[model samples]
Target: MTTPKPRHLETPTETTERERCEQWTDQLFRTSPMVRFMAKHLSLLDCNPLSPFPSASASSSSTSCSSCSSTNPAPAPASAPGQQPKLVIAPCPPSIAGGFSPSLPNEPTSHSSILLCSNRIFSKSHLEDTLSHEMVHWFDHCRFLVDWSNLRHHACSEIRAASLSGDCGFAREFKRRNYAFKLQHQNCVKRRAVLSILANPACNGDKQKAERTVDEVFESCFGDTRPFDEVNNPRLNFKATDEAVY
Candidate 1:
């Protein structure tokens, strides 16, 4: 007999957090031009909701779209042919703000799932950054031949995610006190990429292995920005100039 997956009842606080995150996610999907562009182009715009939490709800609360001024926002166009992956708001490891899980080999067309940690995300910007970061993984999954099991492949995607998702933008780095006068953006991307790669089980928590893999993929992955025309996606509030430390 197969063992059952564990389930948990959400506390009142957890429920509140989940609802807030779900609303923000829905809002970004509907209203953010960059998010909409990526979702549509990547064919990940429509996502069925799934969760292991007991309070899992399949639909988000109806909120008017500010862009269209419509009480009922128009539904996203149907996803490309396949079993579309879900967008889940569930508990993740305390350290993870969000993640993307690729579909199994048998389900090639279906991209996979994007997970948002209910307890880890604190504000709208945090949610936005996390979603965009995970979407970069989704983009790589769809557009490239990614071997998720390979450390170099995983490192490449993480590096691209960090560079493109505005995770290492100057303002954010400044806030984090990562003040380096030279190659600040590159340094930030490398640091974040190594940390993210270490989270993968294949790295075996070897910081050196993760760092080395990141270096191997760094030059190529750091230069590749496909869906977005450039690094630091135009839709992000921070400008490219902000990345300059001088």
Candidate 2:
């Protein structure tokens, strides 16, 4: 069976949400301290909501290497490659947007990525939190820190995102419900991490691989916290630059 592709959001309401996303993404690179600090290698670009997703860079054979035969796939250099240049912000179908990686499927993503999203359901603050989560993934990819093919790598990133971002915050959770007793944040992070990891079909359709991978990396990834000690707010201050912010 052919997998259904993500539908592009185009309704009147969706258009407004898309406009808001573009503004927020631009603001993030400009003001977000954590994002700017971590994303030194990446260059922020002007994005058009109507523009198509950034095309994948083609790996053309190096004609410069006269020593190798033209037919042979040029041997990959030993050194690690550079980070994907820009983080794209695009609108995706409701099913895939908000929480999914704009990274290409089944790929660790050596090239650029899309920040596929819509602000219809989530607030501006919520959107920033989500962007920060993806940015962590971008940090890992750019630095060649992990083998993206490995399920454990993905699981570890998810764990870090949940633990680092306010995704598992007590205030966000208890906003509606008046729970008598306070709950531990770790439990929330763990549960959210599992759900995210298991969402990947590449991790084997919500079965053993995804769960086990999370379990194996849970201690290490959850324990390995950075940019924050443990669940502190990471809001950024946006400064106006030469380019006008919408």
Candidate 3:
């Protein structure tokens, strides 16, 4: 008689649990190439959320700005060549309220030449998340080089950025730090869903509609929960990965 292979030692449930944990760990460690690529593009803008603008003479580029005298300078150049051109941040015009709008929230209409916003509020860690979120919008606008005429297109761009943000290790870290602040100030359920949508590559479509579905799923699990402070949070301690869970 032929010898039979020995039976597996582990029970089915144990094996399944082990597999699930492995999958989770894999996700936790996965790195997103897309996020890295986009970050490469972002580095070109050279805007530092932490500091005020530096003088025009200090910048490497040809562009000059009257506002740089008052604002913080950008962080060291992080962008790659052949990427989107950088913009100068300047003071807002009196005509605009709150000194900015989501459409062009960074600078005043008078200084229309700048590509990125230099405003202090946009640079705050939490606000940087918003700015990063908006930059994704601008990135799409640049990529298509046309108006996002359809709802599907808008949804696609947001989804793309969100997915990239989740997988992009640096972007995710930036988001986590920024989000930590918001979590301290207000309910994080909605914010978490927004972050989830940004981090998840699967949620793109019909912007408003997609948001509703995302919101539902988040509420079901988090239920208006506030995240622990970033200093003490366990989830933040994990390394970034392609398969990482948020």
Candidate 4:
């Protein structure tokens, strides 16, 4: 028998949340049907941290579509009718640092573009989180064009995308960030109400209810389960509000 060659092992490198998010986005398009659909209509461009990739390159320029290049020509159009949408992925220009902005009407030529920015300025999770957010924007824009109201529905869509992107952990992080913002705003009553609802055993699916209930009871009895005094102190015009308010 011929000797089998040993498989090469790649070393793992530490990555920030933003880098992780970009990776997750790449993986998502590769696997998710809905994501793949969106990817077709919307180009996901990776922004170069080193040099500025002008919006001009994204719009006015007509480079060959990344998905249609010889090495990876677009797959046979999905069974569904209509022409398959095309997508392009490229490095983001250096000028726009924190995040990529979705195309705006003023920049009509830039429509159907998704900017992927450098991760140095944001947590790796933010890159993925923002991409998911932008994808929802694209879906809305595709269906509604320029209707401003369509963006309102994006919050829920973003949540679903982020969850499905294998970045459900971002949900918890989002809640934490929101909580901190609320605290900073001195919205204690609202914060407590929100926390109570999040702490509810029933919200996390019925299957998890039993375990969550036990955990809640244990925390109530032994842990500092009470909301922060600044947030729920009865002396400061605080009153126990309906949990549903959250």
User: TM-scores of the models, in the given order?
Assistant: 0.76, 0.62, 0.28, 0.32
- Residue 77 shift from truth in candidate 3, angstroms: 5.9
lDDT tens digits by residue: candidate 2, 1-246: 111122343567756665676566555545556544434322222221112234433211110111212222211121122212233334556654444333455643444343546533366666666766766666555444555567788788888877665666566567735343544566666676677776666665766666677878788888765534444554433322322111
- What's the true lDDT of residue 112 in model 2? 35
- TM-score of candidate 2 relative to the true fold: 0.62
lDDT, model 3: 0.32
Question: What order do you get sorting by TM-score, best first?
Answer: 1, 2, 4, 3
The superposed Cα distance between candidate 2 and the true structure at residue 16, in angstroms, equals: 1.3
lDDT (10s digit) by residue, model 3, range 108-227? 222112222222232223223333444454444443432233334434444443332332234444565744543432233344435444433454533465566554444223321111
Off by over 4 Å in 4: 1-25, 32-34, 40-110, 120-126, 147-171, 174-246
For candidate 2, what is the lDDT?
0.50
Candidate RMSDs in order? 7.5, 12.3, 23.0, 19.0
**lDDT ranking, high to low:** 1, 2, 4, 3
C-alpha lDDT of all candidate models, in order:
0.66, 0.50, 0.32, 0.33
Off by over 4 Å in 2: 1-9, 41-85, 99-110, 119-121, 175-183, 207-209, 227-231, 236-246
